[model samples]
Each structure stands twice: as C-alpha cells, then as structure tokens.
Target chain A: MGKRSARLENEMIEYLPRMRRFARSLSRDAADADDLVQLTVERALTRLDQWQDGTRLDSWMYRIMKNAWIDETRRRQRQGRHLAPPEAGESVGAEDPDFDKRIRAMSVERAMATLPDDQRIAVGLVLVEGLSYKEASNVLDVPMGTLTSRLARGRKALEAQLNPDSVEAGHDD
Target chain B: MMIDDETLIAFLDGELDEAEMERIAVAIDADPALTDRLERLQLSDQAVRETYQPIAEEAVPDHLIAAVRQADRDTAPDSETVLPFQRPTGDRPSRPAWQAYGAIAASLVIGVLIGSRFGLTEPAPLHFEGDRLLAGGVLATALDRQAAGAVGEGDTHVQLSFATDAGGYCRAFQQGGTAGLACREDGRWVVELTAPVPAGSNGPIRTASTALPTILLEAVDARIAGETLDAEAEAAAIENGWSGDPD
Candidate 1:
C-alpha cells in the first residue's frame, strides 16, 4: 500500500465507531446498520480517488453510507419488505430480550428509532454525529434550510414520543 | 431580529456565524423565555446525542474492521467483502468489547449499573475521599497510565484524553456498561460524575472508551474549553503524567 492509502485507512479505522452510530440511526437496526457501514467502507476504499483530499473523510464516508442505505431500502422494498411500525422498533435493542427490564434509560434512543428515515438521518448527522449544518447538508445532499427543517421536525417528534404529556407546538416558524 | 425555531436551533447547534451567535447569546442572557426555550431544546438534543453515542464505543464488528484493513489489498478476490455474513455468535457480543482484548480489563469491567445497585457493587473502581469522589482501583490505574485509545492492561480504556484551559487533563473512560469522565486534580483523578451506560445503546454494545452520559458530557463541555488532544498531544500529556503543558 502507498503511504497515503495507509494513512487514509488508519483514519477510516478511527471513524468506524462513529459511522456505525450514524448507520444505526439511519437504518434503525443494528445488524442492518453494520451492513451499511461495511458497504460504505468497501466503496470508500475503492473510490479513494473520488474523495477530495482536502474534504472531510468522515463526511465523504457518511454520504456513501447514506447512499448505500437508500439503495438497500429500495432493494428491500422491491423484495416486498416494508418498514415495520414504530411499536416494532421497541425491539431496536432486540438482541437483548430482557431489554425492557435492563435498560430503562433508553427511552431517548427508542423515540429516535420511531422517526421517519429522513428526519432520523437529519437528527443523527447533526446532533449525534456532531456534524455542522453545512457538513450534514452536504452529507445528506440537502440544502441547509432543508436540513434545519427536518431537524426541527425530528426534535419535535422525539419530544412528543419521549414526553407525550409535555408536547407543544413549539417547532413551527 | 426575529428568532424562529430554526434560528434558535441553529444557534444551539453552533451553526450560526459569530455575529448571529453573539446576538443569540445576548438575547438568551436577557430573555428568560428564550433561555428556557434553548434549554428545553438542549435537553432533547443532549438525550438524542447520548443515546446514539454509546455505539461508538462498541467494538466495531471484525468484518467492518477487516474491510478497512484490506482496502489496499482490493486486487485480491475477496468475495466475502460483497456478501453479508451472520454476526459471529461465538463472539458473545453482548458483553462490552473489553473482554476481546484480555482478562484484566474483562475482570475489572462494571458489575451492574442498572436499578438500585448503581455504583454500589463490589470491585467498584471508585470511592469517596473527603467530599471528593476519586478513582480508587483499576479506573485510577487506567487514568494514571493509559494514553488515549490505548487499551492497556488497565481495567478501563481511556477513550479520550484532553487538556482543560486550566492546565489539567480530563479523560473519558468506560468499564463495561459504565462510562464517566474524570479530570486530573491535586494529583488524583477526581470523578466528576458517573452514569449507567445503556447496555444496549447500539448492538448491545460495550467496551472501549465511551461517549459520556449527558451530564458528564455537559461537565466536560463546560470545562474542556475546546482543547481535545490529538494522539501525539495525548502521548505527550501521558508522558507528563496527564498534566497539560505548563504554559
């Protein structure tokens, strides 16, 4: 491997943890998210020339993951698979059957999983991944205004889901 | 200037330009309602952030790591790269990834942070000294010894090591499903706060250094002064006994 490729690979390794977090938020499934992350890694490694040297590698990788996820979601739909309802997302931590009794503090993540994919990705990229609005917009291929609106909607949805009694119409312009 | 939810949220996310940020900061200081709105938004933002953050600490699946390592070797016919494989059940991934490294870290990992047993289990890596709770056992050893991202023989992995503006260092650490931040002071690792890391935040994930619980993150944000150390800086800090530069 060339020295540049090796350095980039190391950077890619550092970013895997965060990329997985973004994938889970987008896919709303752990196993599915890992698939998305792996796909992104493979794509990014081969397309190293396409990634601009001065640009943020993480952002480039995120865009790849987002595109891969869209492709996967479409493929799943074509196979007659549909998204499950929000109630089904309670199994987000599905690996642990005892999740209810074990992790009471997970209401936040549960609420997040209930969001629509666009809103969830907006929230994940900006809030969870700590991407700036401009960076997140580029990653999602949306305008900054679009990103903010989705984020506001995602935040409101999460508020209602997490604290239904305290819901308010505070998100409207 | 009218501050809509988008503008306020933009300010909250640090996306506003300096002038806009200053304007919002002043308005927040002057208007209780604005401050309340911002705080409420911040609460939800922090919660959402903390929820997904634990995923970063979970061991990156081996296949994913393998993909990255083998990126330069793409000339080889690695058909498995294109195929999805069942998660290795033999790894018993439910436990935090600490066990994958060695027995010492596995042994010193958290017992139980859930329910009423929080912070009360035996082999707890922390205890109180006077009014200050300090790192007692392996957590202390890890904080004292491990550089950032180096999961050594210590029970804890120091995921991040950064200096505060006050010339002291703080580290974000994880011991199994337990994660917290401790800053160096008085030659001791003072525990600012510790919280139960959601065991299933991501793929029933655990181990490695973690993103702190919201409260600990708030504390770190308030104190870190925007000086998170890079690897070289972290190594130098460790060589200097986890203290920030004298200057």
Candidate 2:
C-alpha cells in the first residue's frame, strides 16, 4: 500500500530463487528445501525491521533459514528416524544414474553437514553464498581465527571426501 | 612460504594476503600436481556456482512479495503510533476496555485457528525454534562417525537402530535430549534428520521407553530391517566395531 511496503515486497520477490538454492544446499530434498525457503520468506516479512538497509540481505535471510531449520530439526527428533527408501529390489543405480555425480553431490553435502554448526555456517556463507571470510565471520559471530580454522578444516574434510585421489587432491579439489 | 590446500582454498576464496597468493602461484607453477588440483578445485567451485547461478536469474515468486507487502502495511500503523497498542490510562475506562477486549478476542480466535490447522499444539514445535537448538559439539562429532548399522558409545546416544533396505545401519539419535537421525554413508554416519518431520504417523510403539520421540520413528522405519536392535543387539553392534548392514 505504501512506498516502503512496495519496495520490501519487490526485494522479497527478487530473493526467492537464491533463498531456494541455499535451502536446497541445506536440504537435499527439493520439496523440503522449497518449504524451508518459503518459511524463511514468511518470517523475514514478519520481522522486517530486523533487517537493516545496506546489510547483506542474503545473509540475514540465511540466518532466519538456519534458525528455522534448527527448530524443525529439533521438533522432528521425537519420531524422526531415517526412512528407508522402498525396496526396489537391488535398487539399480539409475543405469547411467550418473553415480559419480550423485556421489559427488552427496559427498559434499554430507561432509558439509558434518561440520560443526558454526563452521558449517561459515562454509555456507563464504564458499556457498560467496560471502567474504570477513563477512562470514561477522555473520557467524566468531573470531576471525576461529572462523578460519573451521573453514580450513571444513574445506579439507570436504576435499578428502569429494575428491580423494592425488596428494594435493583434498588440498584444493 | 609454501602454500597448502587450506591456503589454496583461502586464496580462491580471497582470504589470502597478496604475498600468500604470489607464493602459491609460484608453487603451483612449479608443481604440476598442485596446478592440476587448483584447476580442478576452481572448476568444482565454478560448477557449484553454475549449478546455483540460474536461481539468481530466475523470476521471483509472487506470494513472497505479497507477504512482505502485508507485513509492511501491518508495521506502518505501529510506526505512526509510538504506543499504538498500549492502553491510555487516562481515557474513559469503558471505551479503552472495549477496544482491549476486542483485540484480545481477535487474537485468541486467530491463535486457535492457527493451532488446529498447523497442529501447532502437537508435541513438536510448530515452527522454527530460533537458535536454541541445532546439532552442536559432541552430537555433531558422533553423527560424523556413525554409519548405518553401527552404534558406538560416548557423546552421542543411539535412541533407536534399524537397517536400511540398502543394507546399511541407521540410527535415530538424540544429543543432550535434542533428537536427530544419522545413517551410514561411505563408512561414515551422515545425518538426515536435521529437518522437521511432517505431522501424523502410523504411531509405531517405541521399545526404548526414553526414546528420542515418535517423529524419528519414520527415520527408523525408513532404514530399519527385521527387528530393531534390542539392548543386547545394540550392545553387540557397539562392541563388534559397528560393522553390519543397517537392514
């Protein structure tokens, strides 16, 4: 109805896809990730003043998403055992299911999930969201050294799993 | 100083000093392996970026815009009135009382509607819990180590155990009373229960009296085969170095 309302609405519209992609990275399931992003949008709108102009909007939204996910995770704990996929009888690997591609994606996702929450947050911000290290540290509320160590270890672990071949494989790849 | 992979990732991420980048460039030039790895890492980063790049290019959804618009409208009035909702003690008690009564009634009705539709009164949190919960410390550590069918002692508690049809072990877990689930992947436990489970279930009876919660039962069903791990079987799984099919 008003100028500020219209501008905020436009900004939210612009953020959907990026928010969805980040949600996807956090949640491997397409549907679940979309739900998470939608929830993020709803919450960010509800708490509009919390967001300051000139701050990284993506990071702020991400903080909301992370908090939402954490809450969801806790709620699910009561009966949330990992469900087994239907017994497809030897579940053929997609016949050219691109096993390597799936493995690569899963490997990276799994390793990233394993990182301590703060480190994972940092990795997502810096490596995934393209936030600078300084920005990530500020977002994560950690000392630069702490953030660096976490990032370094998280990167190394991911490298080891995602590309475990040459001596320098884990180092860079 | 000679650069390592950590330094290389830092460099690629622009965390490195200019001197460090120059040093790594020299080392990369001298070492074919380093150069190849750098190229691959860059390519991987590029690929991840590319995979998500389309999101930035895609059109934003309309509903999200509408929600934000509605929120802004709601806030505008509050912005104008420094204490819009607060009672004016000096006003005619009857007039203020009626307004207060009306607001309270409206809020109560809205709350009830939300509760029923979303199962908000159910045992679990209806929405996000802010920062009070998420995997942390020892819980994070244990999830990293356990794979399907394996259970180990220590910081993490395996509340329930099951085997996947894929022949891997999966466990419904809790850390400091916060529930989660992790399954074995590539000989390591990978967590999959970091999101909320949808409402309703077949309501399976849990053997562990103090089991994490029923929300995690679906996770167990998803991966458990045969009977669940009894105390003895669970102990065996832990004792035998945690090697077995989750099924």
Candidate 3:
C-alpha cells in the first residue's frame, strides 16, 4: 500500500471502536450496526480524495457513517421492511451485583433510541461521542444554533425519562 | 451575566471563545444555583459516556478486519495487473465462483434479516419430516443438550433459552454459519427465523438481547412471557429437558 493509503488505514482502524459504538447507537441490532460500519469504512477508503486535509478525520468519518445510515434507512423504508421495535431494557450483564447498573444503561439506550433520528444523531455526536458543537453541526450539515437546540431538546427528553424527579424539579424553576 | 443552558453547554464542550469561557467560569464560581445546574449537566454527560463505554472493550470481528485488508489489496498498484491464473499466496483456498456467489446471496439474506429484524433465511440442507421443521444434524443435538448460557465449541451452539407466553419454551441457536430462534411445539423444536452469522461473531453468548439480530430478538420479544430466564432458571429448564410447562 502507498504511504498515504497506509496512514489512512491506520487512522480508520483507530476509529473503528468509536465508529462501531456510533453505529450501534444508530442501528437497532448489533449485526446491522457492524454492517453499517463496514460499509462506511469501505466507502471512505474508496473515496479518500473527498476528505479535506487539516480537517478532523474522525468528523469526516462520522459524516460518512451518518450518511450511510440515512441511505440504509431509506432503502429499508422503500422495501417495506418491518423495523424492529425499540429495545425494551433487556439486561446486559450476567447475574452479578452490577446487573442493576447494566439494566439502567439499557434503559438509557432504549430512551436514546426513542428520540427522533435527527435528535438522536445530534445527541450521539455531541454527548456520546463528545464532538464539539461546531464539528457536530458540520457532520449533520446543520447550523450551530440548530445543533445546540437539538442537543438541548434531546437532553431534556433523556432527563425526563431517566431522572423524572430531577427533571420535574428543574422545570419548577 | 445570566448564562442560558445552551451557552453553558457550549462552554462545557469548549465550543465558546476564551473570553466567553472565562465569563462562564466566573459566573459559575459566583452562583451556587448555576454551579448545581452545571454539575447536573456534567453528570449527564458522564452517564452518556459510561453507557457506551463497554462497547469499546468488545472484541473486533475478524471478518471486518479481512474486509479492510481486502480493500487495501484492491487499492494496490500491481493488483490491477496481476495475472488471472496466479492466485494470492498465504490465504485460504479459493472457492468456486458459484460458491462465492452463494456466500454473497447468503450475506444478502442476512442483510434482510438485519433490516427487518425478523424472518427466516433460506433453509439449509436439513432432513425434514413433513411440514414441521424438526431440528436435524448439529441443530438437533445442540437443541437436545446445550444449555442456554453455555458456550460449546461445536459448530452448533445454543445461545439462549426462555419460556414463551404460550407456556412453551423457545431457544435461540447458532449452527454452521447461521443463527436462529426455535420454539418447542408438540415436542418438536420449530424454527422461527435463521440468518447467516456475520463474520468474526464467534464470541460468548450475549447476555444482552440488544446484541441479537433484530429478527431473532423480535421473535424473542413477541413470545417471551416476562424477562428471559436467568442463568439458574435456564439450567433448571435444561435439566427438565426444556419442557414448556415449567413448574
């Protein structure tokens, strides 16, 4: 491989874990998420010329993944396939003291899944992936204000579901 | 200066200018209520990060690595000029073109299963007794002996076992290259749905139903009476020969 291609490959490998996590958040099933990540990496590698120098490679990859997920969802819609219901808080950890924590985590994931696709992506980018607001806006191709509003709305929804007492108390102020 | 939640969030994310960040810092130091709000936001951020932190520790599937390697090879300069008769060395033996196409077709079936999250793939070559699909070959043995949480080295592995709402028991199994869910009806394990197992997926049985393929998971969701059986329950069920009528 050329030095440039090798560098790109290394960078993509480094991004794989985060990409898989983002894909899992977007996709309902683990298999589908991995497939989406595969497709995203393949597309990115094949079209590396499109990526601008000096830009964050992770952000560029995030954009590709987001677009690929959108396309896949559209295709599924056109095919009239039944989308899986949101995960219903299936406990992840084996029988242990940490099981409760795992259950809470599952509930959080389920709540995140309930958000609208746009809001979910916004939250995933900003809160989950720790992307800067500007970088998230760039990935979503939205204005900064739009991104912030979406994040606020998504965070509010999450707080309502995950911590109703605190959310209610905050609302009184 | 009164700081709004969005501005506070931006400041937390380091999205604001240095001046704005300093102002927020001073305001936060001066105001107890604002400090509480900022702490809440910070906690929420930490929770979100922690929720997905486990995925980073999960093993990467080898098939994905192979795909990346294949892309690298395809992009190499001499790859285009390689002789047709010359096969690549150090790789597994190449299958016939038809088998390659068959794998692609199976992959597409798996894709459909992933998208719809429920449905059966094309049937493998299993002996059928009338219309009722009886577990044959490795599938039959796995259904007979494998416990829900146990991970067997054989080609057929039973991943989960639980009771259906109909008072019958169902088990999810992966055999050969496909994964599926089967419910016991009239003493026979009837196949619900099967799809090609994606590459590098041979790991321990997943405790999280979320990791399951949508179709298999949907079938489980539709039939499960309550929560899936815990490990102790599953072991007892296995001991009882997976009798749908659990005591």
Candidate 4:
C-alpha cells in the first residue's frame, strides 16, 4: 500500500468504533449494524479516489452507510419483509449491576428503532453521533432545515416514549 | 425574546452565531422553565449517547476486519498487476507451460458453476425436503463439521457463525454459485435465505472471498442479535453442533 492508502486504512480503523455505534442506531440490530459498517468500509476503500481531500472522512463514510442501509431497506420492503420489533428488554448480560440502566438503554434503542427512517437517521447522526447540523445534512443529502425538522420530531417522539409521565401532562404539545 | 424549541436545540448544538448563543445563554440563566427544557434535551441526548456507547466498546468482529483488508489488497496497484501464475524466477520447468496456463485460467474462473469450485464432474443431485432445501451430501457434511472461514475439501464453505435474536445459531455458507444463510432451529439447520449467485458478481459466495452478497448479508443481519461470534466463539459453536446454548 502507498503512504496515502496506509493512512486512510489507519484512519478508517480508528473510526470503526464510532461507525459501528452509528450503524447500530441506524440498523437497530447488532449484526446488521456491523454488516453495514463492513459494507461502508469496503465501499470507502474501493472509492477512496472519490473522497475529496480536506473533507471529513467520517462524514463521507456515514453517507455511504446511510445509502447502503437505504438500499437494504428498499430491498427488504420489496420482498415484503418487515422488521420484527426487537424483543423488548432483552437482558444485557447477567453480571451487569446496572440492570435498570440497561433496561432504559434498551428502551431508548427500541424507541429509536420505531422512528421513521429519515427521522431516525437524523436524530442518530445529530443527537447521538454528535455530528454538526451541516455535517449531518450533508450525510443525509438533505437541507439543513429538513435535518432540523426531522431531529425535532424524532426527539419529541423519543421523549414522549421515554418519559410517558411528562407526555401525559401534554408536554409533547 | 422567548426562545423556541428549535432555537434552544440549535443553541444546545452550538449551531448559532456568537450573538444568538449569548442571548440564549442569558435567557436560559434568567428563566427556570427554559433551563429545565435545556436540561431535559441534554439528558435525552446523553441517554442516546450512552445507549450506543457499549457498541463502540464491543470488539469488532474479525470478518469485518478481513473484508476491509481484502478491499485494501484489491485496491493496491500490485494486486491487479500480479497474476497467480507469474513467478519472479524465470525457471520454467516441471509442468508444461500449457498446464500452468490452464491452472491460471481455472483460478480466474473460480466461482463459475461448471468450474472446479463446484466440484461437479457430473450433475450432482440436489436433495430437498419439501420446500426446505436440506443440506444433503457434501453440503450437509460441510455444515455438520467444517469450521467457519475454513476451506473444506468439499465445494461448500461456511463463512460466519452468529447467534440470532431468536436464540439460535445461524451460519452463512457458500458453494460455488449457490449461497445462503441457515439458522439452527428445532435441532436442524433451517435455510433462511438462499439464492443462485448473480452473474459477474464478485460477492463472497462466488469465491472464498470475504465480500458477502448484500442479500445474504441482509438475511444474516436481520436474524443476528449482538455481534457475530469471533473465532474462538465460532469454534465453540461448531463443536457444540451449532447449538447456541448447548446444555
């Protein structure tokens, strides 16, 4: 490998963890998420020439994964295969001391999975992954305003689901 | 000026200009309700971050690493330039040049159904039980004993082993032009998704390659729970006869 390719490989490996996290949110399943990450890495490496210098490599990868996921979703939809809702509150290891915390986390994940695809990606990128609005917009190929709206709606829905008492008081309105 | 939820969100994200940020900071300081709103939003963001934090800490599976490396190798300039038959030493001897050429040609056409990868000199009969295709003959033997990522003597190759959300162990396998994802359920390897390999596609099924077909990968993904088993776990699963929770 040339110096540039070596550097890119290193950088890609460094981003793998975060990429995996982002993918888990988008894919809502560990295996699928990792597969998405793998596909993203493969696509990025093959199209390294297309990645413009000075732009964020992570954002470029996020775009690739998002697109790959979209394609997968479309294929599944065409096959009439719907995602079965994840089994709720699947135990997170028996030794875990923070059982409540784990349940709450699983709840959030389930709630996030329930969001519409666009809203889920927007909230996941901006709120969870900490991507800036512009970066997320670029990743999703949406305008900034569209990204913000999705984030707002997703966040609202998540908040309602997570904090039902607050929502019962009409806080969602 | 009253801050709207969107403005507060932008403020939280640090997306606003200096003047707007300062104004929101002042407003937040003066207003308890606004402060509560900001805190709630921040808490939600923190929760979301925390929920996904574990995934980052989990070890990346070896197959993904191998795939990336394979892609790197594929992209390297020398990869395309060097042929399997090309040798540095000009000493051409034992076998005829035509034999060497034939070997090279065969390797080039590795995954075609008629090629050696399929291991079919004559048409091999396919056995099926109703609509479910049972892995009989060589394919069954591979599923019964072959370790993942290990090239079996038979045409079938098991690629990955993982635990499905349904509490079963599933394995992805490929044999020449055929590939599928099978899960262990009710004491049998149930084929979840199978299809004939597409023409001109370099998906993992066609070769001992790590690049998985999108459809097969999706099938595996839809079923798997946490990450696929690493090498050690996969070996153990195979030893336990593909039972995820072998008692």
Candidate 2, A1-173: lDDT as tens digits: 11232234445656677777666556545556667887887777667667887676767788898888767766766667432222312211122367765445554555555556556556666777787878777766778878788877666665555566745443443
Regions more than 4 Å wrong, model 4: A1-4, A88-95, A167-173, B80-247
Better of 1 and 4 by lDDT: 4
Better of 2 and 4 by DockQ: 4
Give a tens-digit lDDT track for model 2, residues B83-123.
22212334312121222323322323333344344333322
TM-score of 3: 0.55
Candidate 1, residue A79: the lDDT equals: 92
From the highest DockQ down, the ranking of the candidates is 1, 4, 2, 3
TM-score of chain A of each: 0.81, 0.74, 0.85, 0.88
The number of residue pairs in model 4 that clash at the backbone is: 0
Q: Model 4, B122-163: lDDT tens per residue?
A: 222233467764444455556767776566644466767788
DockQ of 3: 0.13
Best by DockQ: 1
lDDT of 1 by residue, A12-80 (tens): 878999999888777656677788898899888777768887788999999999888778878888998
True interface contacts retained by model 4: 0.49
Ranked by lDDT from best down, the candidates are 4, 1, 3, 2
The CAPRI category of model 2 is incorrect
Candidate 3 lDDT over residue span B1-247, tens digit each: 6888788888878888999899999999999888877777776666667777666667777666545545554554444443222122324222223233244334334433533323464333243468755664345555766765343323345656778777888887754345678878766677766664443332332111112343555566677776666668877777777784432
- Every model: Cα RMSD to truth: 15.6, 26.0, 20.3, 17.9
How is the predicted docking of candidate 1 categorized under the CAPRI scheme? acceptable
